[model samples]
Target chain A: MADPMKIRATASGDVCEIKVLMSHPMETGQRKESDGKIVPAHFIQTFTIAVNGKTVIDAGTGTSVSRNPVFGFKVKGPKAGDKVTVSWVDNLGDKRTDEATVA
Target chain B: MDATRRTLLRGMGSTGLLAAAIAAGVLKPTRVFAAEYNKVAFEAKDLAGGLKGIGAASPAESKDIVLSAPEIAENGAVVSVTVASKIPGTSALAVFVEKNPMPLSAHFQFLNGALPEARLNVKMSQTSLIKAVALANGKAYMAQKEVKVTMGGCGG
Candidate 1:
């Protein structure tokens, strides 16, 4: 099982700021170990964020991202008490889903 | 019983399960998943090639697209980048780091009137030009900024 993602959603006036921190290795497949073996490419391929079950952002990421990636966003429609869920699928078919209530 | 050995054992355990799944026909390996990773874009040496790899032909320079990043990155391994488009009807946003081994970092698609904004952390091999491209009404607009890296990222 993958580690749980950390998500925060704060509403200010009409916009809600959402921040996420994902725990991942984000290996680019280009790096080699001390034994001179190439590490296979293993990274998050797709990331999605939804508010109240409505999709807001769908992203495609590559190995170039840093380990334990952090993402932020601003949405207009969501208010306090709305459901905000963030999920990601990695290259190895591993999936993680976590959610936070809009504050 | 070191950390490296533990990690290796864990990796081997996952691989063993994957092999077992394949043998049991629980997971049918398909080309769809394999083709999802854009190898060409990641291998592109220049900005034009990277853009071409992602299917953005000629993006016009625009000030409406905001590329928020620090002028100096204290840590290149986790530099915060945020791209927001002020253009109406924006649909997509892509980020590229010109100096990294791979230029194309992340691509985002917005649907159902979602705001054209994305914030993510990227690794920079060194000081590089960070570019943001916004697709609005099928037209592409780009904005870029320079970020100096005090410490090298990307295994440099």
Candidate 2:
């Protein structure tokens, strides 16, 4: 549906963290096709990140954003070796989920 | 066949690409332009289903989350972007394209909320909007903006 996802994380002076990237066009539904048809606004309304099955970051969106977005956040109480799960949904009702561990 | 012609162009070099682009312009602009619609249409199901994995989130403005990108990009083909969230309960964070082929472009979920952040370069076919939704403390909050792509990045 969108694009392949990429994820990265690191230690900020002894603090471990992770980051992620997703592919999307992020249409605002206000544009038109070459033929002059209205393209409806379609974007991921919200997404979540979990570490060790616990919640850490929660966010949402509308049409006032750019496509192929990136999200960054940090979590403490974890070592260098831990897992993080990420997921999202779009305006057209599309969805994607991917996970990676912190290095 | 149209498929053959498209494949031939795909197989060709820059010269072929230019010639094909010219041919496409003369033959059918609407069909060529609508090709990206298939991308957005196709990613719909996967994006919708993926978002449902998490139930809810608690919203908070964490100085931990940092969004980095050019305030204005000369080209949208591969605009670099990065996000970082420094919070304890950040289980997952995701990015979305409001008007791309599929809305849910990518997602990052961790075994624990101990680490949540990411960086990537995404392709924008035209001037469009983008969004990022985060999950924390069982609630959700978000940010959004617009990006202008100078040329056609989505494959014609």
Best by lDDT: 1
Second chain TM-score, each model: 0.75, 0.57
Q: What is the TM-score of chain A in candidate 1?
A: 0.97
lDDT: worst 10-residue window of model 1 chain B:
B28-37
- Residues B35-78 of candidate 2 have per-residue lDDT tens digits of 11122223453334334533323244445566666666676556
The prediction achieving the highest TM-score against the true structure is: 1
The C-alpha TM-scores of every prediction are 0.82, 0.45
Error of 1 at B75 (Å): 2.5
lDDT of 1: 0.81
lDDT of 1 by residue, B1-156 (tens): 456544543454334454345336654333323224454675677778888877787899999999999999988888889999999988889999988877889988886546789889998889999999988887889999999999877762
Report the interface RMSD that candidate 1 achieves against the true structure, in angstroms: 3.7
